[model samples]
Target: MFPMQFALKRGMKAEMPDMDIARNLDIEKPRSRSNSHNEILTKDIAGALLDVIRDLKSTLEDSRKSLSHSAGAGCRCSTTGTTLSTLDEYSTSGPRSSDMMGIPPEIMSYVRTFGHEPATASDLMDWLTEFEDTMEILGLDGQNGTLDKRSVVARLALKGKARKVVLAKRAWLARQGQQLSWAEVQKSLRLAYRAHIPEHAMESRLCRFNPQEHSEEGTGLLIQRVLEIMNMGESHDNEYRLFYIISTLPDDIKDILLRRPCPTDEVELIGRVEDIELLKVSMAMNGREQGKGRKR
Candidate 1:
């Protein structure tokens, strides 16, 4: 009887080790290489999504170019053999004849900067607000209006129904905490015209800009104006510190005026004063060219 009891106890001890090994395997399973692959899988999915969005945007723009000249005849049918209905059927209504005029070059430039995202009316308003804030930091608000952007945008968006739609959309986005792209904003403007949103609400006290008279000249103007403000400060550090204040501009502005474009001209102008390495080389090259000109 004693020998049998000892045999049973040894067998139970052997099985206990196997149970611990199984428990450890279960706990550590998620740490396997398969889990590591999930991060890579997520990145691939994001890349695919962006590519699809780009394709959709390209198709939309191509369709717009073709249909804008069709004179209300409606779009051409797809390969599926169904007639493509007028955008008005899906959208609000046909745009008025007057609404077919030209889009501003600055507006076009703005939209092109965003790549493939669809533009909406709200995005244009936000851009106006952003640019205005940038100008304000440079002390370029010659009109000295209130700093409230909603008020400012409402006043500047005065181009008729388009402006009104932009303002309302912006207001809605602001309430919803949603941001729109420049391309999206432009798309919304075109779509709004089809949707038959009334043009009357657009004629607000704030939506009344005349760009020829009120526009900031260009990027150079803003830079020059900012330098002037910096020059007025008492201490050298105070002048240098204005940069920290300007850095508060949104990331979108930074992407445009700072990152992609590199602000080469602006940087070169500053390099003349600061004489950093790249700037020094550029200035030396300029000097050599000028000397050759003088010799001629």
Candidate 2:
């Protein structure tokens, strides 16, 4: 054992160059990284791996194309059990569909800001589309099996202004053992809350359109809200709307707009308002930069 150890040591010494063993002892050999760093490197490696994977993908795609007689195909498997794409579409590994979760604050904000007024069918549809967009972004859509088309409609009736007639009927159905769907709830809300603004009411509604006084946010949001309410009244005269908006502008923005030579055209006038306000923002930024320079 001793002779074998000596022979092996001598062979190693003869074959290898001289080493600064003491200096190297403090030099870190590559230590195992933290899980986060490993994940980052793993993603980089995966990105590079995609090129090779794409070639394999293209071959299978081409083969599928040939099978379908050179016609294009759907991404997922059809009723005939043919899928023509990368493994990612078929991959059931990694995270489960339900395990994935993302809920934007906008959806919660929308949910919270209900019961303010009776919405028209048009208004409700627009609101539903927005909230649905957030749901889709969050992966809480029908495809993920976490939500259905009717789920959004049901949610609206459950939360806000439609809660009186729409929600009451929904509760009544539940008690009566009638299984009502989201579409049914949505239809009910439209019937109950669709606003038919009379000729006289339009002016009154327009007059009542006050800007939201956000303590934290300044004139930008107030101006935006005023613009939004102007659109909401459904009075088709853009010229009237434009001048009315100009007349109603907050003091700071109005002062800035008044300084410019106003365009006779209402469209041009509205354009000038937006353009000049943006200019003022740039001017303010320049002022800040000059102040910073002076301080320096």
Candidate 3:
């Protein structure tokens, strides 16, 4: 064993020179680079795996977005269906057709006040068309007109239903012992046109029509005479105040004004300023003459 070890050392010493010579010679060693091709293949495989992973991630993201969109659409459809079902139930439970046919007499009377002349059938039909359109929008059909709204409205001047209403009103007025005077008619006209006139124009209109020269100038004069008769005197200031007072007139007086065929009272027309002083002077003169006769 000792001899073998000594020979191995001697051999290693001799091989050292050969090792040095081989190192000096340009000899190719058995190469780890033999496995470099495998390494390159592995790197290519890694790159492919990365590309697949990236594609898979993009696909997953697109799928997620599509699913979210589908979920949102489904939610909207369900909400819309529920809303439609609720509306359908409400419509089924609402008022019936027969209850919507009748129109209120008060509303009819208000329409009547728009003109002194009786409304033609076509006029009424046009009004009805407009009113029905309004009512349809409001969902107020099939309801009865209220009966207790007796605001002393005048009937439109005409035959048939309108004439009948006027006749009935006249009879009612007679029972109440009321007379439909000219003053009343004037007041009604004022009430009707009150909303139409501008505040500034009323003064000019009144000024243009002098009672002496233009008594029958226009409808304005009739209004002036009516104002005088009612003791609604000429004020120097604020013509619009007078108009406001006229506009806010009592409903009873307004009704008389609206009625046609002005009523008559047997008493002669007299102004308070003209009559009261005359009466006082006449009574004083009569007393003085009686005292003079007694002294004689």
The top-ranked prediction according to lDDT is 2
| TM-score: model 2 vs. ground truth | 0.22
In the range 1-296, model 2's lDDT, one tens digit per residue, is 11222221221121111123212222223334432221111222323333323433344345434434422344434332545342322323212221111112232232233332212222333444433332222232223232232233233223333335544654565566443443444345334333322343433343344432322133454355446655555443433434444444443344333322212233444554544344345345456766898999
**Backbone atom clashes (below 3 Å) for every candidate:** 16, 0, 5
Q: How big is the positional error of residue 142 in model 3, measured in Å on the Cα after superposition?
A: 18
Estimate, for each residue in 1-77, the C-alpha lDDT of model 1 and write its tens digit.
Answer: 11322221221111111223324323122222232221111222323333433443344455454554553565443
> Which residue ranges in model 3 land beyond 4 Å of their true spot?
1-124, 130-195, 203-247, 258-296
lDDT of 3 by residue, 1-296 (tens): 11222221221111111222224332233333332222111222323333433443344345434434554554222322322222122223322211111222333343343332213323444443332222221121111321111111211111122222234434555576454333433344344334334464644355333332321233333344345534655442223234323323233222223222211110111111122322233334455766898999
The most accurate candidate by TM-score is: 2
Q: Give the 10-residue window scoring lowest on summed lDDT in candidate 1.
A: 8-17
- TM-score (all chains, Cα) for each model: 0.17, 0.22, 0.18
Give the runs in model 1 whose Cα sits over 4 Å from its true position: 1-106, 110-118, 140-260, 263-296
Ordered from best to worst TM-score, the candidate numbers read 2, 3, 1
